[model samples]
Target: MALEAIKNQETLAVLGKKFDVSPIVISKWKLELLDKLPGIFDRTGSASDESETVDTEKLYAQIGGAESGE
Candidate 1:
């Protein structure tokens, strides 16, 4: 629906009627989607950088096990 709104594929009134939501609510959803789109595509991976840690040793062990099927 938000994509439809962004593409102007249909009027808000039509979308609202089809989805059983108010036109204003649809507009808000469209705005919210627009506002977050940039972050969604952020390639820096900053969103999860703080909470994630790569265990190189564990990864290497897994790779070795997979190669040997053990």
Candidate 2:
């Protein structure tokens, strides 16, 4: 059921209904599964896109010297 939920990208509540578990239980299971997913795959680790940053080298080259704080 966890596998099905992950595979189908369905909500935990949806999977919970199918498996006859409470949504909160399913939510916890989903959290655990997500926590392990990166390790399980090995090839794809998690990364964030929220806070953008620039490489120091690229910043210096592109923006040039003191103004860019390189």
The lDDT values for all models are 0.73, 0.58
lDDT of 1 by residue, 1-70 (tens): 7888999989988887786666766687799899889877665656567555878897566445544542
Q: For residues 1-70, write the lDDT of model 2, one tens digit per residue.
A: 5566667677766776666665555565567788878766454444554244757796344334323331
| CA deviation > 4 Å runs, candidate 1 | 43-70
Q: Please, what's the RMSD in Å of model 1?
A: 16.3
TM-score of each: 0.57, 0.42
Model 2: per-residue Cα lDDT at residue 48: 50
Query: Which candidate leads the pack in TM-score?
Result: 1
- Predict model 2's lDDT versus the native: 0.58
